[model samples]
Target: MAAGIQQQNAAEDIVIAGAGLAGLAVALGLHRKGVRSVVLESSPERRTSGFAFFTWTNAFRALDALGVGDKMRGRHLQLQGLRVMASSTGEIAREMDLRVNGKLGPHEVRCVQRNVLLQALEEELPPGTVRYSSKIVSIDDQDGAKILHLADDSTLRAKVLIGCDGINSVVAKWLGLAKPSESGRTATRGYARYPEGHGFEPKILQFVGEGFRAGLVPWSDTDVYWFFTWSPAPSPDANGKEDRSAAAMNQFVLTKMRGAKVGPEVLEAVERSEMSDVLAAPLRFRSPLSLLFASISKGNVCVAGDALHPTTPDLAQGACTALEDGVVLARCLGAGAERGFGHEEGEDRPCLGDAIVGAGDGEERERVVAALRRYAGMRRWRSAQVIAASYAVGFVQESDHTVVSFVRDKLLSGVLAKTLLMMPDYDCGKL
Candidate 1:
């Protein structure tokens, strides 16, 4: 450390990769904890084209803790219940009343465009805190400091590295965690505007048939978010993107259900959707660690969000869990600094502008690891339960066998439908 050279400031050195919901929520949470974080997004600019996201009461409480819930006003379309229809008859088979479920708290879950929420989070961060177009190449936790190697050949070191970089996270792979498992089916998502001549009440509607299923989640009077998942799937298109050919996918589904009973309106809506509006993806998830990592901080590194738990959207718990991670991590840091846990042994901690600083090789390493393990331990089981339930939901919806489908449609739907409505405390957002 020489005179006139700027030193690192731990308060300003927390770098979060990927500016998706998980990354931004963590930044917002860190701000509330009096910890400054610099968010690094690889995208050239902010995105506004994301589809709809639903927020349960528990997630709302978590957002409230980050101080941004007020912006959600007028964005929520309260769900009254979930509706399941018979694939062969198009008759309502079951409904889960949400009114009774409201007893846990305000049951009015909010739905908003994902981009709007991202903007809200961006606005809450300190000006100039996020750096866009700065992509990460490699992260090396060696010689004490956790060093981030950028594609541009620059470097960043910090007391800890929280990997919110998402499913393909380079950081998690560097830590030797196994890659996420690809669920055999492909999932396509899109929004359909309520064009003229259309009339349907707001509801959470799902239709199931052999080899495929579709879900319609209403977000407002103007739009409906829908997705379809199918098995024995086609390979990814040339660009490796999900099969976004809406006309093709929908046509495949319509053929599979031809002469099968379903509402004409639902069928019409699917047929009319054009190719340009759909987004597609192959679903994936990490193998659950029987024990939360003994240390997320291996030496000077840590991971969060998708890097740690890439959940299936079947649960719709992805963003909620990430938001919780952001807040909890920030809470630990802000709280840790107060207990004098920010510095490495022997050497002073690195400041923002200095060469990377390490969290030390022995006692300091154990302490940081212990903190992260605690954080992971607190979060892992809850996440595992949600993932399990989500898989079961998918199984019930995608079953094709006549006997199994009949039993599921007639007997299981009634019970499972109601359970989803009342599963309180599912979102650990309060932390």
Candidate 2:
């Protein structure tokens, strides 16, 4: 009762599945636009455990549009830039500064905590905005509304439905989008603490070794976030596969770091990690080209966030893009969250389409459909580019081939630095 998180009592007008980063942010953004939405989380409560991420300028613009920029800006430190190092020699491979004053003015890059970002957006909503323990098992479209059949045997009719549910999303499945394919690479991410202070400068430190790549970002005075990504050697037998257990994963990272000859101080974070803190998983992403003609929306039901496009974390843009999805989705919906509202004749911006009410069935459906289509169209190209670019970057960085390494370390070092700088220049536009 004290917090805005609440249980749903009946059918909701606008229903968003998955109360993670995208669902919550989209719901909140919609709230700012005077559109009400209910977020359904499959968990029993607000799940907050997550590693930190590099929030680039595009993410900050999305946060500002969502009206929660200051809350996060106060919590994390701004990183000046990052240094990519060659693991064997501990020599800098590429050093890129993030202080570019380009397209969207000066840049803003911070290694922000995922839990804090989620909680900040949640606090800005009214009670009952999010319905935890709510899972949509199946969905279907009737006359105009999408009927969401919950796991608890109840149902909610949504005038407009957005599937922010992640990778294995039921809504996305219902829309018949292809399942995300797993890349050959895997990643382990966790945090390290140095109470007296890590004594590291305000920037990211990365290490590249053969098929393994790792990086560390110090976000606070006491805590540092780190991640290691590698392509596991293909095993002929199932028993030869890498262990998926947390303890095993922690040991694997330490062993790999030692074998790579990474500096003692640099590998200290993994060695100091609690077995529980070290988490690992195989990277997965959608085939970017499939999205070109994907069925993202059918009538009033559409997808966003991971449900829309789950990109690899190589670009450090998974959550950042999710934040962007929220702002763009809400902005496009523009008061069209309510049914029977159509834009007035020739109105450029939305908001229930010029307050047209008592419109015919087609008119009402067109307004909602149009809004969803606009959002899907606007985000499709951006998501595809992210998915494609992330995989390409990961492939290049983690390639252990002799020729590839020579090309990367010799020919493309400057290009790597430039690409990093240019990635965040994208502006997600205003609400």
Error in Å for residue 45 of model 1 = 1.2
Count of steric clashes across candidates, in order = 6, 2
| lDDT tens digits by residue: candidate 1, 1-431 | 01111233223356777788778887777666555677777776776655776676666767777887777645757666667777766787777655454555645565667887888999988777677766778866545556677665666665567777888987777777677888777777777777552355656777775656777776777677777776757655788854546666766656655656666656655666666766667777776652244244454456777777776666566667777777777666655444444432233543233233442335444555565666666776765666566666676777777887888878887666654655444445443
Q: lDDT for every model? A: 0.65, 0.80
Task: In angstroms, give how far residue 39 of model 1 lies from its true place.
Answer: 1.0
1-431 per-residue lDDT for model 2 (tens digits): 22322334355567899988899988888888777778888888877666788999999999999899988889999999888888666677888777878666888899998888888999998777888888888886655566788887777767678899999999999889989998978888888899999988889888875788898889898999989899864233377765777777777788888887576766788777777787777889999999989988877788888998888888888888999999988888865644434222343433342212223446756777788888889888888988998888888888878888888887887876766666678888777
At residue 410, give the lDDT of candidate 2: 77
RMSD of 1: 5.4
Kindly state the number of residue pairs that clash in model 2. 2
Flag regions of model 2 displaced more than 4 Å: 1-9, 233-241, 335-360
